[model samples]
Target: MVKDREQNSNKEKKLLVSLIWNFSTELKLILMALLVIFTLATLLPFIPSSFSLSASDFRFCISRLSSVNTTTTTPTKLSPENNTTTELVLDRVLDNGVIKRTFTGYGSAAYNFVSMSAYRGGVNTFAVIGLSSKPLHVYSHPSYRCEWVPLDPTHDPVSTTGSKILTDWGYGRIYTTVVVNCTFPSTTTPVGGNLILHATTGDPSLNLTDSIPVLTEPPNSVDLTLYTSSTKKKQYDYLYCGSSLYGNLSPQRVREWIAYHARFFGERSHFVLHDAGGIHGDVFEVLRPWIELGRVTVHDIRGQERFDGYYHNQFMVVNDCLHRYRFAAKWMFFFDVDEFMYVPEKETISSVMESLEEYSQFTIEQMPMSSKICYSGDGPARTYRNWGFEKMAYRDVKKVPRRDRKYAVQPSNVFATGVHMSQNLQGKTYHKAEGKIRYFHYHGSISQRREPCRHLFNDSRVVFENNPYVLDTTIRDVGLAVKTFEMRTIGNRLLRTRQ
Candidate 1:
């Protein structure tokens, strides 16, 4: 009887276990079905809606978020003042200082960009250059305060291959640049010569006649800076090489260039020699005296290795006398030696710039400038295959014709957008205004046009009709310019015709 009872109890326990197992399995299956439904719900946003989202929509969302953050948070005060030169602060973002250095004046406020590491390439050399409008007595000129040091013969590295030497100047300051090819290269044999030394901070004690020591070191890199007093504060000017290779201007040529620049700027402005490559030493030596006699100090800015092509055009500086003494100037012109973009007005560059400054909204300082496509004018200007570099040409401030080129100017577009022909602007739009300022771009002769004219060209904020104003001007002249006489409309229309 007892065994039979135990058997029955075991049978009951087995039955209960079977029931629990079946219940749990069914629950798991139901859960999995629910999970699938939930997943589909989660992915619903990705399914195409009646109105599709666009790339610009995403950008707009990001912009909105950024704007919100900006509006919600107040920027903390920086530990050190960057705008004003006071006591120096170490290990802080030189944001304002870097901005001041990169963009010199009024329109700089419109530049909405940031940079890190003021000299990522490296600023190892410092040099000081002095320029005198009137010839100064080398013995007594107050501007002769800087020193030119000779490359140390015994300490320099030795090599037998042609090499270049770079140096740094300045005790340690913001004005630093890289000077290239200042040292003698190592050849199969070492040649020694007396290298003339220039003094920094007026060291009368420097040995004036020390031969630059022969170096066996393969040419390395260097950086430099320059400093000078403002003797003629109203007549100060500085020349910076746009793409290096500025050592080629001859002395007589230098004088003539100075005279030309002086006439152009209405002050004593001239070109100052900096550093140069081996192929250009003859021109370098000719201009070295002006650098040595406290007239000009050459600065060598380090460039990236990528720019191994196009050594044809370089930049030289020109400005009113006040540019040197005061760090402010009316206009800063950057053009290649082969290219000159002349304004079509009798007003000084400063007056033109001021006109823009007074009229421009803080956000967009760059006024649209139309280029007067000058041809060689050797023959009937119209018959030529576009204008070559030699012909001085001008266009009516109304419209531009169509063009077919790899790169076309943008009609109604600022000169910075496209070149040769105008860009098409069918669906885009921009903010615009009719103001006091005007822009005229004189692209001399298409033959001398440089390649990759991207940075040199960019579209304006506004477009006309369904096409970009930078491409053609006919529509704008007929529609917009006639109504408002807005310079931008005319500018855009002229740019479009060239396209």
Candidate 2:
């Protein structure tokens, strides 16, 4: 009976020990599962919710978490104060390789349809578009096509060996050249097409598009030979400036402009004037001598209206001039009639060019001269005598850097041209002649029709009286010539009317 009792106690003790061991094993498994759940919760934010975590993914997450040094690092956060200065945040789409997020509020993305020309082979077309931002992709398609054709930097037989990429012009603007080949041949003078620009930023669903009404004909097909003279055939070492003149300008103002450039540039200068406005017979008569001498070539573009704004048409005229005299002239400048290229330090533009021989391209800073300095308390005559020759004596209301203003370039080096910048240069060396050369832009003095300059008055008291390159004799001579020409023209018109 005692042996049996001892045996029962031992059995009871063994059962108790087995039960405790099973409970402890179960508790350890439950704790391990809870620990795993906590780890997954911590890593949930980093991993995409749509992606299911496989064994490899879990391993990757574990390695990534292990590599992070949380103790030493601080979290990065974007705020308004550091938005402009901070590096832009970029995100890539998982399905499609597209940039979904980019720096915003920098500048608005915009583009203008410059011109389109038929390729030499006639199977392809060349299109030029001016943009305000760098676009991710550009597409061109015919009206009949349902799909958009991507434009690549393919070789262009017309402009250069390779298609011109987007060139930055500052102030949030760029210029891109695209080549579009027709899928099916159509017997049309100017092929109809549309250009779609996809920007690097913004809602991926939206894009900008412009119509290309006439792509077959080149923009320069206009009668460039209308004012060509025998003397123009000879290549000269001169700085030539071209401008597309629109609207009616005062006869005196016209003469003053022509004479000012003529006197300043001397014999080593030529002006190509595209008369988009109906210039008076008297003005033409005054310019007839210069026209015959090939010092000035005027093309009547009165009826040839292409673009909407006057500024848009100016780009076309600039491109036309660029192609027309690319080989004939050494250097070329594109700006408005009111603007003058002033080299304060050097005697002539050639001398300035000589100094900047190492650079293939140079931009001139624009100094906006106030109208108050243009005209004194007196009339236009006294204004010319006092401030006309002494333009540097006037105060500049605003000054724009060369990168933001008009430029001069070797015509051969530039593959494309813009109002304020040049694109696709052979050497691609652009130098800003900030202090050496200044573009003295005279506004509101003569052309009051311009809305922006209408309110500007001779009000500012600031003056640049210390400048030493005032051309008093040239101003007097040019002013006198203009007055004489006007007098003779009015007299002739009066005689004709009497007859």
Candidate 3:
């Protein structure tokens, strides 16, 4: 009986050992499987699903994972429908020289600032133009002296060509310069006023008006006597031409350009030059005789920083000339130094004006001359004789071929001017002199050449044997004199430098 019990106990111990060993093996297998699953979950995001996965996409996915936390315990406030709510916040307002306004219900909207200026004639009249979110009815009221004056119904608001609504909210946002003529308390005294612009969105009751300040004097008013060289004090007859010159130009070239105009226009024409920057001292020396003779005047524009770019400053310079010579000059031609006004039918500009006397009967004050562009050719001579007429004698030259249009104008009829066009305050008409006159634009050859040569016209496809005008011998003579003067000046400068 004792032997039987011992064997039974040994059998039970072997069975228990086999069961424990099997359980341990199964646990190890399960733990290994779980470890594999965990590893795969961690590395699944690292391995791209497609071979075509881009670097940007991978970076975006990494950024998103880093921004989110799956183990967060804090509960988020969820909407009733479990949807996310977004709120738009208004940050800050910026006025980068443009008019901007933000409305409560209509979101934020911006428009160009309303500008108001009194007419040069007197304080009784002023003009305003700007962009508006709604169709605005502009009205004027004097601040320190007079009461609210309604805009003249006869002078209604007009849409300008380049004006447009910047925002997507409304239509007809462009408001042109509407002249508001009001009876002032005193015309001589400079008065400050405010313009009230009423905005309407179809409904008359919902109209809103905003006040804009108006000064009797313009903020950018240039001195009237700034750049005049005439000593006689006589009115400039018919045409007074001027140009804004930038960059270092040869003295001989400068004299040739000035002399060409002087020869063609005669004593009736006077030129004002605004030397913006980079004008060599030699240019001034070459022009000293003309400067003393009151034919050419040069003003240093290095100090003026009113405008941003070179072109804008040029426009301002031209406008200043207009205001300065308004009473002194009958007509003003704002052109570049390389450009020359040519009237094939007449010898002088005064004669051209006399020919257009019939057109002036209809109150046509300004004339628009088209430009004929001339290209350069390989040549030895830098200066082209007779204003490059022989070299550029082709009929297919680029020209402004339109009637009742002109780039030149009567100064008294113009309020302001741009680079090429004038804004007339007197509501004058433009007569285009397409066939009768042409602006010789010698930009290509004038800046490149140093001597007069016939080889410059070799590349011209077409050539004409007939001469356009009687060859002005005075131009050639003046050119020679200028060349001689430039040479002497240069030699003297070199000698002084050596000493």
Q: What is the lDDT of residue 132 in candidate 1?
A: 17
| RMSD of model 2 against the true structure | 19.3
Best by TM-score: 2
Residue lDDT tens for model 2, 1-499:
9999999999999999999887997889999999999999898889977878589988998998889532222334467785644433354454565445544333334343344332222223233333222233333321211122322224211221123333332222243333222322332222233323222222344444443433333334433342234244436455555556655555444555666667566676788888777355756765775677678888776543543433435555566566556657777777777676666643666677788766667777776654433323344455434324333234443333432477877775665676777765666555558767776666644453221221212433533443212212222324455445535433333212100
Give a tens-digit lDDT track for model 3, residues 1-499: 9999999999999999999887997889999999999998898788866755679999999997889533223323435575865443333334554333433334233332333233333334332322232333233221111222324433323221111212112222233222222343433223332333333233243433334444334334533342233243537764544555666565655655665666666676788887766355777776676777788778787654332333424544555566556657656666666555566543556677666644321122123211132234424344333334333333332234542323666565555555546544455444556555555444443444344333233333533343222222222234454445535433333212100
Candidate with better lDDT, 2 vs 3: 2
Whole-model lDDT, candidate 1?
0.29
Candidate 3 RMSD computed on C-alpha atoms after optimal superposition onto the true structure: 15.5
Model 2 scores a TM of: 0.47
- Ranking 1 against 2 by TM-score, winner: 2
Candidate number that wins on lDDT, 1 or 2: 2
TM-score, every prediction: 0.25, 0.47, 0.46
Candidate ordering by TM-score (highest first): 2, 3, 1
Off by over 4 Å in 1: 1-241, 246-261, 268-331, 353-499
In order, what lDDT does every prediction score?
0.29, 0.50, 0.46
Model 2 off-target regions past 4 Å? 1-234, 239-241, 278-282, 303-306, 373-393, 397-404, 449-499
TM-score (C-alpha, index-matched) for candidate 3? 0.46
